[model samples]
Target: MYWSVVFPGMTEGQAKWLLPRAEEGLPGLLGSIVDPNYFISLHVDRHSAETMKEALLLLESSDSSTESKGIARGLLEAVDDWLDAGGKYLEE
Candidate 1:
């Protein structure tokens, strides 16, 4: 079965891989978001400040690859800025 939430450019195997990770909360969910717009929406609308904070900390300390961490870092920074700007649209 496919996930109800479709991620851009994601394959069936990737979706399967993402499912369990997503259940682990923001740390798991952040990496699979290929679209910046979706990340912004999730950060602004779904997650709270505290949740994002914890995710940031956890991801920073995680053993994931440098590339993945780098991507997540940038996304988190965008989230921070978006939150600071009162959920304004982030420029691509």
Candidate 2:
């Protein structure tokens, strides 16, 4: 899920596809992944990357009312700060 959202050059479909591989190859993919707070990006295909990027661009270009924009900006700022502080969004 982090790979899907935050991984560079990887698309959502690629991220989803690599879920099993990441789970299976952690020991051998990049030396080792025993740390409880570690994550690795597995792989990304070109087609999937382009599609997701296009959707992301569309989303970025969309406009909204002032209230909606304010809320969105606040959420993005919170997410950015959380990321800067090395935090993960946990699904409760």
Candidate 3:
């Protein structure tokens, strides 16, 4: 419950693992979301495109770790691909 307070679905171990990185900066926080499936679903389904863009900006501006930046990049690409393929359906 302690870690899940911030990210609801994450296990205690996951939260524990993320805490240190999150304390570092925005990249740390974003990078801490290690699961690609969860990351894509959470951002693509829940966040606006503008917000996702901002996160991308944060990653670019900060000293993001290679692994963390990689994960974020993957999420961005997945979201973009989904939007491209599902654009018509979104309006309905």
Local distance difference test, each candidate:
0.62, 0.49, 0.60
lDDT for predicted candidate 1 compared with the true structure: 0.62
Q: What overall lDDT, based on C-alpha atoms, would model 2 receive against the true structure? A: 0.49
Estimate TM-scores for all models.
Answer: 0.40, 0.30, 0.40
* lDDT digits (tens) for residues 1-92 of candidate 1: 11246456776578668777777765544434354445443424434654675687688789988987887788677667756766433452
Question: Residue by residue across 9-76, what tens digits does model 2's lDDT show?
Answer: 65556766766687687754432222223654434343444444455444456775666656555645
lDDT for model 3: 0.60
Using lDDT as the yardstick, the better of models 1 and 3 is 1
lDDT of 3 by residue, 1-92 (tens): 01222466776587667777666754534334455555543423424754675687689567989888887888677657655655333346
**Pairs with backbone N, CA or C atoms under 3 Å apart (clashes), candidate 2:** none
- Model 3 scores worst on lDDT over the 10 consecutive residues at 38-47
Best by TM-score: 1
